[model samples]
Target: MNMAISSTPTSFSKSLKPSLPKARVFNLLKTPPNSHLRYTLNLKPPPPRLLFRIGNPKSKSQFKSHHSPIRSLFTGIVEEIGKVKQLGSDDDGGFTMTIHAKTVLEDVNLGDSISINGTCLTVTHFDTQLFEFTVGLSPETLRKTSLIELQMGSLVNLERALKPSTRMGGHFVQGHVDGTGEIVSTEPEGDSLWVKVKTTPELLKYIVPKGFIAVDGTSLTVVKVFDEEECFNFMLVAYTQQNVVIPLKKVGQKVNLEVDILGKYVERLLNNGVVNAIK
Candidate 1:
């Protein structure tokens, strides 16, 4: 499988600063044991946060972010599946998209961020009565991600940004897709499924047996790694098989792949001599 990277300054995210990499995939892929849904054991409703404000606050619920909501974390636990309702080109070299969803729209406001597949997108327009929302996609985002593969009626995994009180059963997922890869194969082992994905060597370097990876936004653990083949595999149990869109995909399909962020951070530190300075 061919894996490509784009360092283009534009972003698919309307909210992220130009520095954040363009989103690479939306058919993005993740599993349960590695899922952070378990971390949300704190069932208490999160204390009200100091909502970021805009020109004038109509209400606390109308808050918006002036920049990327990077402070927010995603635990790679999918909440629901959404379908693309409308898609078309915008004059600004981007696209306008409206998706049909319920769970992610419950309290969604003008600037709220929702991870479509594994890419975080801000809500630009929405309608509670219709259960749909619209967001803008930059051209770089389309060049880099599988979202370009999306069409009306395509299913996408949906996840909301984590609140102090939200449940976290998966691992910390940055929702910044590294790139796209092909689902090379799939096998079923009774009540579970074993799937293999082939990506580039640069991405495969961070994947290890038992390490965490977010596929299309579902947090899952790596079951095996095949360095020579530039691929890896993971299993989805009966429960996850039904909850996510991964199991439903076929061989040769493209899925979003976000290797754990920790590895990249460490690499950056090592390269910049931050680790050496600390030592």
Candidate 2:
């Protein structure tokens, strides 16, 4: 593919300008129709060309989010919408929360873990008739998550724990919220909705454009991440607009955020190697 002259050939004689001694000369031969011109230089042959590989071309799959395989995890797929029936302080200085849901409670148990807006909690009690379940939120959960913003009659995204037979629709979510982000803005594009969230750099360090980020337990692809501004955004299609409670949230409100767990695992692995090498 590397040719001295371009494919668009110039006048063969005009292009060739070789200063030669009187004894030896490169005679410009007559041109052939529809054929590439070749120069038979009666000089020394050229040396062998050297080659070296630099790097691979940029991938077209940059927009694709990676999936992490986890055995018992929340897929970040909201199974149903639930209402906060109770939000009160417990004797342990923690919060006792209750939600009224049906789908997640169909096969629930006392010790079963359920994700409420991406915060994993163990079911302490359930009532088949009432179609509700109770969970206790520890002080650490309140400090790390947006669960403290819950109030009575508030709508929440609910999802049951993953099972072997369950379909993995979204990326692996531990239902452990990394932090809370304030809704900076929301825009409507036709039927879809674009939501922008601003968080601290502590959490933004793990977020990346085209990667996965769970907002309020709904798995969504990050459209863009503004590192300097400490904000990230994702779009919700028409279907998602109706399925989750995110669409109803207005600007300035906080939403629970769970960054992709894969990033954390990679960071730990690489940092450990550096420490070992130093030793």
Candidate 2: tens digits of C-alpha lDDT, residues 215-251: 9999999999998889999999998889899998767
**Alpha carbon lDDT of residue 258, candidate 2?**
89
Residue 31 in candidate 2, Cα distance off native in Å: 81
Clashes of each: 16, 0
User: How does candidate 1 fare on TM-score?
Assistant: 0.75
The reply for model 1, stretches above 4 Å from the true place, is 1-71
Question: How far is 64's C-alpha from truth in model 2 (Å)?
Answer: 34
Q: Candidate 1 on 8-34: residue-level lDDT in tens?
A: 222222222233332332223321333
Worst 10 residues of 1 by lDDT: 46-55
- Model 2: weakest 10-residue lDDT segment is 47-56
